[model samples]
Target: DTAVSQTPKYLVTQMGNDKSIKCEQNLGHDTMYWYKQDSKKFLKIMFSYNNKELIINETVPNRFSPKSPDKAHLNLHINSLELGDSAVYFCASSLFGENYGYTFGSGTRLTVV
Candidate 1:
């Protein structure tokens, strides 16, 4: 079974369209996060939520929004998709108050065509 899951592994769309990517973790962890990995393979943390509360928000565009319905789920929604937004979106989870490594989901590749 997968520790984390995200939909639309490959997304192809025209610029200016809105798209969303959903994520879920089954590792019984309290902290969940979203990350974006650019073409250069630099992964940056976008948002993180613990117990349904946002804890980290990095320098991301306003067009990117993160939603957490519960402790085990966090989703990312993007508006007015742009070519620069094309990247691999990864969902991850880690245990709070513990030095545990993050478990990453098979990323979603977004392409602005």
Candidate 2:
């Protein structure tokens, strides 16, 4: 029943470990986004890719990368995890234009120990 589904809802790892979060949208939206919410509860847009093309690349660390194999999928890969990397990572999808509306996933909680 999840329009947008992401794997590993909870992730606990040590510093320097690498991890990946997979997101898939069944709504057939043209654009997909990755957002990160820190412990302070501040949401930051990490990346936005439309139709498998890199569109919005925000100011994020090099350890983070977004990959879209097709329009329905967008995955986030994080390398060299750190304690500061602990956050809730959200995946969203939306269509562009006047009817634009975002459909977000439940989010993946990452705890870096």
Candidate 3:
């Protein structure tokens, strides 16, 4: 099984549609995260959760919401999607300790047309 997996790897939608992407990881880590990769390939952290609780928010817009049902699962919801919101989103998981690093999903490419 994949360390981290995201559903709907490709999403093509109209500009105003609302959509959600789901992620799950079996890494047995306490923390999971949502990250957005811009066209320029810069990955920025949008949200982080530890054991179903929100732990970090990296100044992401209100249009973007993250939910963690459990430590193994993290989902992202996007509302009022805009052209600017088109990007690749990645889900990742990692433990909080020395030498443990995040393992990322293959990524979901969202395009608003």
lDDT (tens digit, per residue) of candidate 3 on 1-113: 78899999999999889999999998799999899999999999999998898988999889999988889999999999999999999999999665988899999999999
- Candidate 1 lDDT over residue span 1-113, tens digit each: 98899997999999999999999999999999999999999999999999999999999999999999999899999999999999999999999866789999999999999
2 or 3, which is superior by lDDT?
2
lDDT of 2 by residue, 10-105 (tens): 999999999999999999799999999988889999999999998999999999999999989999999999999999999999996557889999
For each candidate, give its TM-score against the true structure: 0.97, 0.96, 0.96
Reference-based lDDT, each prediction = 0.94, 0.95, 0.93
Best by TM-score: 1
The root-mean-square deviation over C-alpha atoms between each candidate and the true structure, in angstroms, is 0.8, 1.0, 0.9
Ranking 1 against 3 by TM-score, winner: 1
For residue 49, what is the lDDT in candidate 1? 95
Distance from true position, residue 5, model 2, in Å?
A: 0.6
| Candidate order by decreasing lDDT | 2, 1, 3
Q: Model 3 off-target regions past 4 Å? A: none
